[model samples]
Target: MRVSGGSTGGTPSGGDGRDRSDPQAFKRGRKVGQTVRGRLLAPGPQGLFWVNLAGHKLLAALDHEPSLGRELVFRIERLEPELLLRDITPPPSAVDDPALLLAALADARSRFEAVLHRGPPLFAETGAAGPNAPLAPLAARKRLFDWLASTPEAAGLYGRLRELLRLARAFLPVQAGRPVYLPWAFPGLDASEGLVTRSGRTFTLRLFGRLAEAGRVSGIFSLSMNRASYRLSLERPEAGEGLVAALTSVRLGHRELAPVCVHLGPLAPAESGGLFAPLIAGAARPFTGLRLRV
Candidate 1:
């Protein structure tokens, strides 16, 4: 079960007849036998997968159903006919500790929040002007990406942010063959535009995030053109419930929209189950879920 390509060509080289060392080569163009790293964003129609390859979205055929958000290194198996990638990422070690993975995720989230705070103001006040305006979130994201490029220590967090941005981009509605840009009202917040759906004449934009308050807090904000709803789950439920009560009578403007709902409960369990789950189930199986006709 091998993925075929043009040929096992020689190593990529420069005009000087020496191997090129440009770190951004993958972004320029892919070559057969060249290795590239990408994160699986989501599944597409016909068993195809949407992969984020060096800031570019590409549709790829896989041999198995890869878990979403999984990062893998792939060798460019074929460039013509259809882009095929052979997973070359090494499997999780038998001694891999799930605790360490969880800790890393926590650290990444904290670092991401810190970066967001120091970079720019995420949300605009009612009458804010200049830099803190409604478009600030878009600018802030770009600045954060630039900062991540220069700060090597935040590499893990960078991937997570990139993944979130990719997810947000995926939800953008296309019009006239171009995506319609929806400005992020909360400007600099570290929330992903989770979903967008249209039914009848209403369009809804959903945002999701977990922030550190009195411990970690998870929230979902669903906004329509005329109304908004919020669902927040906090570590300290009583405090959040009190806050929601205080804002219950607050009006956004002259119009009274739908009532906002808040839910308080325990944090959802981690998706990765047992410590040895990946080891037992095999993390990188040959993708056989999607079949392509040549």
Candidate 2:
């Protein structure tokens, strides 16, 4: 969702004094049977719960009291007389299951790779040409959502990937230590950020995605306390001299920074295999007494 301001407080009231903050009215264009993601805000009067769904606060009656500030997923059961939501959020134990984590990581990697192969341009603009350039992270996210609207399937995949990543970040410590995956605006592009080796101030990140025009692209970005720089490696048929030419003059604001672009001949598997290597390695270890039957 696009960033917005202001906070909603107190219970909303209708003319008849009944609570007016019904979730049905603020479904955010979602229909019944569709799942909506929200966070548990606080308990309301009369045993109702206040929830923040898509930036709007609505009241819901829950069977069990979920922890405050916990993200929840609910399927819209009804929208007529009253809005009913079924809590579909997975249990913490299930989220921490190695099998589930591996499946999620594999699914995300495959989906991202598929999107990179056939989806729209990763960036609104490649910043290949001078003047109008690629957007910053936040603006890029807005553009990404705007692009995803036209492609519903892609948007759904993005939502699932985002949820899985969030769950992984929250529940899986082994996978979260290094190469922590965070949500990126561009579909199929897994971006990870962490501190550089032996350096507290230097941070590094890598982005992998495909451009409709550029085939497969991998980018590495390094940022220090003051300076930032990036290198983009491309793998496309028939050579990308023109695309490279356009990228040479890319700008990140008013200041022009030199970005290195390398041609890696043909793309090599997109690095999806290594995305969850650590998790897989951890999960594959044999238990103390576990054995397979012949």
Candidate 3:
């Protein structure tokens, strides 16, 4: 006889005097005394420690004071509403140093600016189509991660990134069951392309020149890669224009991220062909639309 409900607290079953340890047979059951990483969130209504681990939000009752927003390893014990956590332990090194996190965020902002200031807008001044587009940038960013690993700069914060590597690698690997999340805060990147660089506060207009077409002007073009997502767009200052037909493609490091033509709205022949060369040259498969375990 197959028992849908077990003898006791919904234990793993069909408990009819037989072992039902078949994982594929039923829903997953957590084994007692398993170690897992946990990130502590803000306090609850009762000031209870709220933790997130392996995409599970759990409550942790610790033997010692806890640091908020920091990840710690915890042992799991079964509980009804949520899992019970014990033996909570901190990571070996400090990973939440504010200064270093800020530096990393700042550096990323600068790289965006560098691309904006690489030169006049790619398509603004040239009609160099049919095979005359600038190549991809040599490097998108200085190896901030590599530098942190090798040097003592941002020692405390660097350690955090290192600690996350075990988890972080899961996100970008060619294939994996679980997806990874970036630790740093993402800044707002608006359509204006306005950025305040450390060297000096300045505004950059990528357009070298703009031509008026039938009471409308368009010259803004941008290619952006966020994590593993690649996006290319051509804008006309005014709306309701016809689509421009042309052939375009992007290749990154031997991978054809985008081997297709871009269609835009009524853009100059010269401008449309030349504008996206940099992005295509640097295009590679991005890390978006990943299915998370959650």
Candidate 4:
């Protein structure tokens, strides 16, 4: 296997014991939160560059232009199946101490105190647009951070605070006339094939697959639903079961809107001929979700 770095001096397997040069393959070994020190390469299109992070040509998209060839430290932020890092060298003290990182988050928390709320747009409702109100969890975490700061346990609160910030960002309120981007799905355990989006009372679900993406029919399943009884069927794709998940539930400013459940039977692909079919459609079958009123 071809591994890139000054020299790790060992064969790099693609984790299931296969030696391949796939960038995504070598990238999976590293986890978010781990720090890497590497040199930046020249910029690529759309503000992406290649940096040698922890002995690999890690891909990064930094806000500012980094010196072409300077050794720098970065903290892994999100694993886009690749690597997204942030400059941790601003305060070299934070390179090793999570407490310093927590301090940095605290500083950012102060600025994010007026972004989102769990329900309707508060600013529009009250016409009070200021930095006084923050997202619910963000504010809660900030207060918890202050309380923790006074205790001896303050030393180990970085992870908790970081995650709270991530969730807040992930579920950031989808504003009117804006597309709702779902939370990041697990590498293999998640599928967007049969996902549904609801705006007001109208539901739009994408269907059918592009014939060019998947060569032939893989499998087919049938599903039918109603108020009294329901039936489901599944025809796993060539890629595997490829079932869908609703774990990343979203709220669209309604009192009765809530996620029904997680994992469900696979949704068969629907391809009755279309130009906008998904590359790898679900089988000859399909999938769905339920909205409950209490």
Candidate 5:
């Protein structure tokens, strides 16, 4: 059976499947109160430039998972375009009806809007002070969506979303608005780097792979940086399966083949209880605590 993220289980053979376990895979999962890092590597310069484009949400994700510190870095490389194409599965209906393609585009746009309109963590209904808040996870997610939608360059983003959906459909089913994750299905990157902390102890992580990227020199570079920074954060020993699921759920897109490298270091956890302190202080207040229903 296909795994939840959409690939057949047990890792892909011949470089066409996911790496079920990292080359450095250990028997243990990360522990609470430990620091973690994750990095993604894209084949070209584009990946590197854009890796932290989602910094707003990334920081929030790290905050939610305290085990993850805020330090992330992206190292990128250049590669050939054809090699990148070799990573993704062919779309079952890419050449179907033009109308259908347009409809899919429309669907993708709408989903993007929902994510955009949600705004930032400070505006979330379940903000840090809210009963359902986990250090404002919802709000942070909102900011990420907004940032992507609000970029000044419309044509570029259009191409990006189109490519992302096409790739998403190839590897997994796209529910009009659900997040999808595409592993190294795209060919471009050779490695992703990050820091791993177990029981408060830290270790550096380097992951190699074949990832896809846009053929354009600019696009390749942008993607490289983005992937490197993004994936490296996952290296933390405390990173859990849920966060992994959420990340892999992001839409994957087409790009040129290129080399991608991620560098993560100087990783550190936020001050202890830094995120929780606000909630604690709010609770200590006489009226604010009373007004908020536990």
Candidate 6:
């Protein structure tokens, strides 16, 4: 049974089962564990304990299915905390006033609706498409699970989730599954070009300029990748304060903080040739620091 999206909740079957007890399996699993550990250690700020939960669940998923490494497929899902709270016990602090919490959630939802419709203010200037662009609005819903591993914010959120899973491993008999790393938070970047300094905060944007010159893309969306941390930050100039505020207010689920795949769907295959030069040059550029703090 080919389960979609790396849902590591099952046993390996058929010929794959022969390798379950192999020492190599344990080694691979250990590597995955280490990745989760590193993610938690590098969440960037203190006072932010909530970010490790997603990593914990990913590690847990890997423990359950060692076969994940063999498969080319990966899946990631993001869940709003309130949508999840009903399914799991809330932390003590959150347990006292479910009604108040719900009310806050409603207000947040209203605010989000207002802002999202207005579109991100900063991004507004850029005129980039939203999570539901190119494709029909309904089609975007199916791709929600794709956003988890794409952006630094989502990554930070995932790091917090993984930490939670590590904590629970001590008491819960949770199985470690295969590692399925997805890049949901990153949107539209299959690759890039230009120059970046190692661990620096700013990198030059070149490839997109070329693409724009050629009229391949509608316009350029600048992307910067930080080598040391593997963080990808996109310039969403249209994103307004409201979206930023929502980002600040957002909470991640311990099991899934960010969707790994934020599928904007495909561009015309013919247009892909137009992106190649930029993609190659961008990826080849040296690492530099990122300035995503806007």
Q: Which has the greatest TM-score? A: 2
Arrange candidates by lDDT, descending. 2, 1, 4, 3, 5, 6
Q: lDDT tens digits, residues 22-138, model 6?
A: 222223333211231211111111221111222222212221222222211122223321111111112222223333333332343344333333422222123333343221122
Candidates in order, TM-scores: namely: 0.35, 0.46, 0.22, 0.25, 0.19, 0.20
Per-residue lDDT tens digits for candidate 3, residues 1-294, read 011221222221112333222222221465444455656554432333444555544333455546776667644443334444454342332133323333343343344334433323323223222232221212211233333233322323333333343332322323221211121101111112111112122211132222222222222223333111211233353422221212132223333233222333454545443322222223343444786796
Q: Write the per-residue lDDT of candidate 2 for residues 129-162, one digit (tens) a residue.
A: 2333331345555555566655555555655555
TM-score head-to-head 2 vs 5, winner? 2
Query: In every candidate, how many clashes are there?
Result: 6, 1, 3, 8, 59, 61
Task: Please give the ranking of all candidate structures by TM-score, highest first, separated by commas.
Answer: 2, 1, 4, 3, 6, 5
Off by over 4 Å in 4: 1-22, 80-82, 91-294
- Residue 175, candidate 2: Cα error in Å is 9.6
lDDT by candidate, in order shown? 0.43, 0.52, 0.32, 0.34, 0.26, 0.25
Model 3 scores a C-alpha lDDT of: 0.32
lDDT digits (tens) for residues 36-115 of candidate 5: 22322211121111111111111111111111122232111111221010111112243243334334544545554344
Which model scores highest in lDDT? 2
TM-score of 3: 0.22
Candidate 6 steric clashes: 61
**Model 2 lDDT, residue 119, Cα:** 53
Model 2 TM: 0.46
What candidate 3 gets wrong by more than 4 Å, as runs, is 1-28, 77-83, 91-294
RMSD of 6: 21.6
Tens digits of per-residue lDDT, candidate 1, 1-294, equal 022222122322112333222223333566654556767666544455555666555545677766677676665555555555556443332114333333333444566666545543433332222332322144534555565445533433445433333322322234212112222333322432234455554444433333233233444444445766766555555555543553332123233345377555654444113112222233333344797899
lDDT of 3 at 86: 50
- Which residue runs of candidate 5 sit more than 4 Å off their true CA positions? 1-91, 121-294
Runs in model 6 deviating more than 4 A are 1-69, 73-75, 79-195, 199-205, 210-294
RMSD of each: 14.3, 9.7, 19.5, 21.8, 27.1, 21.6
